[model samples]
Target: MSDFVARRPIWSLVILVAVALLLWLVFSVWTPGMEAAFGRKRVFLSALFNGITLGALYFLVASGFTLIFGLMRNVNLAHGSLYLFGGYLGYSIGELTGSWLVALLVAFVVVGLVGVLMQVFLFRWMEGQDLRQTLVTIGLSIIFADLLLWSYGGDTFQVTTPDWLSGPVTLPLAVALRSNGEAVLMTYPLVRIAILVGAIVLGVLMWLALNRTRVGMLVRAGVDDRDMLSATGVRVQLVFVMVFAFGAGLAGLAGVVGGTFQSLQPGEDTRILLSSLVVVIVGGMGSIPGAAVGALIVGLAEQFGSVYMPTYAVMLTFVIMVVVLAIRPQGLAARR
Candidate 1:
């Protein structure tokens, strides 16, 4: 942190100011004049929390993408299809069993198994062949999308938010001051907050698994020099398969998360795939911290842009991408 401040004091100062401003905006009670100028605090706070939780959702999907496409450097274009498939399957399972947790577990296992199959049959021999992997996955994505459309149709579906997490909870932050000198606290969907907490915990666990464990060491070593690691008698193929399964499982888990809060539809796969791609590219491929930062930025940009500049909201993401590419193409948290 000190190194960063020393190297780029101006940027550090700018960031500090921005954070301070955001904190003030979040905590301060808005007067009529302030509300008239910048809109209501409730709307702003809602957008802020929405952005945060949405970012958490994006991180879940992109973390898996980071593992496969980012860390392993295998382009799995069918990833989004995996997500949509998981959601549909989870929803079906939830309907049949009336157990959301069971549906989540089943989705993870089933989708992880699918990933293992893809690894064994499709990707095993094509290790260094990016073009082949890309083409095959693209074809697979199309096939998966068609299959899902046939099975589920184009109707929108949302997983039943479990009874435990169904309602809105009031936050401590004041949205406005009542005439009685009381603060009006903001109320948000409890499920979103729960998901955000889950995402954070999951992210920390994943980071620890990848960075602090022996298996993680092997995974990293294999990525850096597969031949050398294989020469070390590390059962590289098995590790690869396990990695694929885990990555795909994470995508499946994220599907359940999305289905809980957001509706699932036909073109949802494409949108999610694009979002994951943007997050990965923006955060720097293969870095978990990068994924988090990238997800947060993209989420906030989308939410705040829609709130403040609806007409250009879609363009804002691409613009951020362009600016990042021009300034720091490696991404904010990616290693130099």
Candidate 2:
């Protein structure tokens, strides 16, 4: 970042100015004129928070995608199906057991095991065959989608939010001033905040595990040259299988999160799969940090566009993707 700022000082300055303006808009008390021009402060604030939380959700889904497609070079296009399956499975588990946390674990484990089967029986045989992987996974995704539709029907389902995280939590940020001269603080759902926090923590842990551990070294080596790693008496295939499982498990976990905050029905798999692909492309393929940056940018664009320019809202996400592709086809944070 420092090097880029030095090389592109003008662009850096523009970014700083934009951030400052955004901060002022968020923190300052809007006068009547400002409110008239920009709508209510509460609306803006809500959009901003919603964007951030949504980005967090995207990160959960895309991180897994980057791991499988980017790192492992396994084109699991059936990923969205995995996410939808996980959500449905989690919902069923949650219903039967009445435990949200347990549902989370079960989804992760079950979906991860499914990933294991894919890696062992399918992807492993077609190693380095991108076109084949793509076709096979597409077929699998269709089959999975049809199966899920058959079981769940066309009805939408939302996972029950746990009791502790169900209510709205008051934030210190003031959205408006009350008539009595008191500030009207912002209030947001606790679950969203928790999801954001969890994403950040998981991201950090993943970075550490991938960069700081011996297993990480093996994984990186395997990605770079599995033949060499295997020749070194390492179980490179096993490592890859684990990575695939973990990545797929993350999709399952994200499914539960999505089901909790949003409704699950047919076609959501496509939406989320596209979102993950866009995020990975924008953030940089095979880059964890890139996924984070892309997710945030996409999330903010979606929410703010919807709130401010409803007609062009859906187009805004694609516009951002196009701009990113034009400026940095490799992505914002390409893997080193």
Candidate 3:
């Protein structure tokens, strides 16, 4: 059985695909019932869109966590704090300059710098010390959270989008609906579309960098075996620093993008941090593709669960994590 499972995971893949198809079939057939229950067909579409958007944001944040943990083996618990800091800083800058672009750039650079500083002053010394790294980062997160609350207050704040992305885009639904006997159109926020596009682009770029570039080669080698990578006359520390900074920059960028749609609150740091952890765990620690897939699953699960099972919505992510762990304790794509 073990040999067969190892030789042909094809059955597992097939089962997954079949399950997805079954779900789709069931949902299609049950659309009318859902509309009857929810009083609208648009609810599903709205939830789906929200899921995609939230998933993109989760991917951005988790990608950074994946890189830092996957390669450096550093458990930076304060990652979400950096995300919140970026959002608040971006919001303040945007308000002052009245330019979202500027805020985005500043937030990315500043938060990235902060990440680099944290690594140099705090994490660099604690290399290979997981316990120390975790505790220190948690401490930093707490300090940052308090500082932010004192400065920004407990009031929730949201970033303003550019004029072009301020409205909704209408999507034509070609399929005839049972109720209308005609095609229905759907409208979704333009920003959501932009977020999805941005995530795809970022994922592609990261893939290329890891697979096609020299630096990416080094990072991959490091992930596989750090001591060997260092012995090969390569500056592994420098690579680690650069990767950490880049990951921090990605987190900051996500903050600005997410803040535009979702309000930034005092506890958002912890919330996003928890979400990123789930993404990493479900996707596999340190796997970029895994993070993307995990983020999408989480996003969809959260949104759809909220609509269909409001009472159980919060437990959906935990359920997914538990299921994934039970089936593959190492995650969907654990490092071999």
Which candidate has the top score in TM-score? 1
Number of residue pairs clashing in candidate 1, backbone atoms closer than 3 angstroms, sequence gap of 3 or more or interchain: 0
Give the TM-scores of the predictions, in the order they appear.
0.97, 0.96, 0.91
Q: 97-182 in candidate 2: lDDT tens per residue?
A: 99999999999999999999999999889887889988999999999999999999999999999998899999988888989999
Where model 1 places Cα greater than 4 Å from the true spot, the runs are none
Q: Sort all candidates by lDDT, best to worst.
A: 2, 1, 3
> Clashes in candidate 3: how many?
0
As a TM-score, model 3 comes out at 0.91
Cand. 3 Cα-lDDT = 0.88
Report the CA-based lDDT of candidate 2 relative to the real structure: 0.92
Candidate 3 lDDT by residue in tens digits, 224-289: 999999999998889988999999988898889889999899999999999999999999999999
lDDT score at residue 319, model 2, on the 0-100 scale: 90
lDDT of each: 0.90, 0.92, 0.88
Error of 3 at 218 (Å): 0.7
Worst 10 residues of 3 by lDDT: 22-31
Candidate 3 colliding pairs = none
